[model samples]
Target: MLRYTLMRLGIFVGCLVVVWALVYSGVAPRGLGDSNGMWVVLLALLVSAPISFVVLRRERDRASERIVQRVDRMKSGLEASRNQEDAVVDGTTGAPGRTS
Candidate 1:
């Protein structure tokens, strides 16, 4: 996840630099008076989105798979704990707090 996030950020920053350069060089149109910075940032974001989506697809998938596995592990742990508690409450396990 961290890797993917960093990669995405890198792509955005790269686009921002390129867009800024283009605007500075008069190749790309600058926004209305005083809105040049905002325009550049927005354009960078727009350009980066698709680039990141395609370039980081593998990283994104790996991150998602890791997240899913972690969630599954948590769920299984909770189920096992619940089963143990149930057994203790039923007096089947020698839990310390059991009266019988």
Candidate 2:
């Protein structure tokens, strides 16, 4: 999970760098405005990246929660079956000291 987060952060940063380079090199126009186009693009990227990351992280957390719930339910069912088996064994044993 930490690795995945780091990888995603690296990709987001790389994208920002690429965008900056493209704008700086004049390969892409900044925008049709009085403000420096690069600054505007940068601002937008800065805002969007964190929001996107947070949204993705929230979704990942929800999915993890669901998986944990399912696993716990499965474990509980297994335990119940084991207990039932134990009860059946005790019933068939008849007397405590008896063996067949």
Candidate 3:
């Protein structure tokens, strides 16, 4: 989870840097005071948002599944270890020559 969050932060900062560079370099056209640049930026964001959301959601789901599976395996291992210990105790106590 931490790694995913960091990865997203990195990507966001990278995009900001690239956009700032473009604007600084005057690569985006000036709109003759019409402010069409704002509209273009908004349109780009609207289009990119859903695509980024879908990709991130898929990654998060996969990571969650992996964590769940790992936890389950650890639980099963602990249970098996406990059962083995119980069996050993039972056998030692149940022998005819043994005293409680």
Candidate 4:
């Protein structure tokens, strides 16, 4: 996840630099007034989104797989705990100490 995030941030920063350069050189239109910086940032975000989506597809998939594995592990742990509690409550266990 961190790797994907850093890559995305890198792309955004790259786009921001390119857009800023374009606006500075008068190649790209600037904002109406003092909003030039905001315009550049927004434009960069817009441009970087698609680029990041395409470039970071593999990274994103790997990050998602990691997340899913974590969630599955957590779910399995919860289910096991629940089963232990049920067994104790139903008197299936030979000796019962504490539920917690």
Candidate closest to the true structure, highest TM-score: 4
User: Tens-digit lDDT track for model 4 on 1-100?
Assistant: 9999999999999999999999999999999799999999999999999999999999999999999999999999999999887776667656655454
Q: Which prediction has more favorable TM-score, 3 or 4?
A: 4
What lDDT does each candidate get?
Answer: 0.94, 0.70, 0.65, 0.94
**What lDDT would candidate 4 get against the real structure?**
0.94
- Give the per-residue lDDT digits (tens) of candidate 3, residues 1-100: 7766665655555555555556557785544566656644554555445545665786778779989999999999999998787778878888544333
lDDT of 2: 0.70
**Clash count, predicted structure 3:** 0
Worst 10 residues of 1 by lDDT: 91-100
Segments of candidate 1 deviating more than 4 angstroms: 92-100
Model 3 lDDT vs. the true structure? 0.65
Off by over 4 Å in 4: 92-100
lDDT digits (tens) for residues 1-100 of candidate 1: 9999999999999999999999999999999999999999999999999999999999999999999999999999999998787776767555556432
Comparing 1 and 4 on TM-score, the stronger one: 4
Backbone clash count, each prediction separately: 0, 0, 0, 0
* Alpha carbon deviation, residue 47, candidate 1 (Å): 0.3
In angstroms, the error of model 2 at 88 is 0.5
